[model samples]
Target: MESGNTITIACAASKRTSLHGLDNIAAEGSEGYDNLINLVEDLHSMNVINSEESKELTNSIISKLKEEFNKDLDDSIIKIENWGAHIVRTINQDSWRLERLGSLLQGQGIIIMDWAMKFLPQRFREKQTD
Candidate 1:
């Protein structure tokens, strides 16, 4: 029926949009991760944090980011259902990870937190309310 075809088309379009969103999040996270690493290296070079401390801090932050966001994103992409509403949910989770990372860096007195904030996606830069 025409209605059935219409529904199918609508669902397909929705899925495409979800996939696009996931791709965007993945790209943004990748870029943010790279920027954070560079900031760590810069801090070390400037004698802000020692070499050992730099390595430790970078590893700790990256490990948590992977454990919290990347793993979930990968798992979700493998499931069909995840291409729908799950994408929307995971996007929020991914953004939250970035915000949480910013807070963590600030708590550690990392002076580059402001520079690091610049790399976060614009949507994330906007304040969110619970």
Candidate 2:
């Protein structure tokens, strides 16, 4: 296994996270992360966890997310998948045109995709810039 560190979810939250360069986090994973895991374990011992578990439960969830990401990363269309690919894929799969989508992002300044858009009432998608 690679050197995996225990990245504390608390330290990663919006309130606690460094606002500077928030766009770029985690360039790559490193080794010698057992120490990090120990640190996270200490956090858990302090009683910090979700309703579903007593401990914060890091490794298993991290592993599962990594597995899902590996599949996406290996995909031919978007190796290092990003927003642009996501836009293209949605259009290709839904038989949507770029112009129609542009109206959502450019005109509205926000693009709500897939399931998240379903909950949005028409009022949420009202008149936009030209």
Best by lDDT: 1
CA lDDT for candidate 2: 0.49
Cα lDDT tens digits, model 2, 5-111, are 34542233332225553422332222223345555666667767543462345665567557855774477345445767878887786665555665675446535
TM-score of each predicted structure versus truth: 0.40, 0.22
Q: After superposition, how far is residue 46 of candidate 2 from its true place, in Å?
A: 2.7
Which 10 successive residues of model 1 have the least lDDT summed?
8-17
What local lDDT does model 2 show for residue 127? 37
TM-score of 1: 0.40
lDDT (C-alpha, whole model) for all candidates: 0.64, 0.49
Q: Write the per-residue lDDT of candidate 1 for residues 33-82, one digit (tens) a residue.
A: 66688899999999999999999989987897679576766776777565
| Candidate 2: stretches off by over 4 Å | 1-40, 47-56, 76-130
Model 2 lDDT at residue 30: 21
Q: For residue 33, what is the lDDT in candidate 2? A: 36
Query: What is the clash count of model 1?
Result: 0
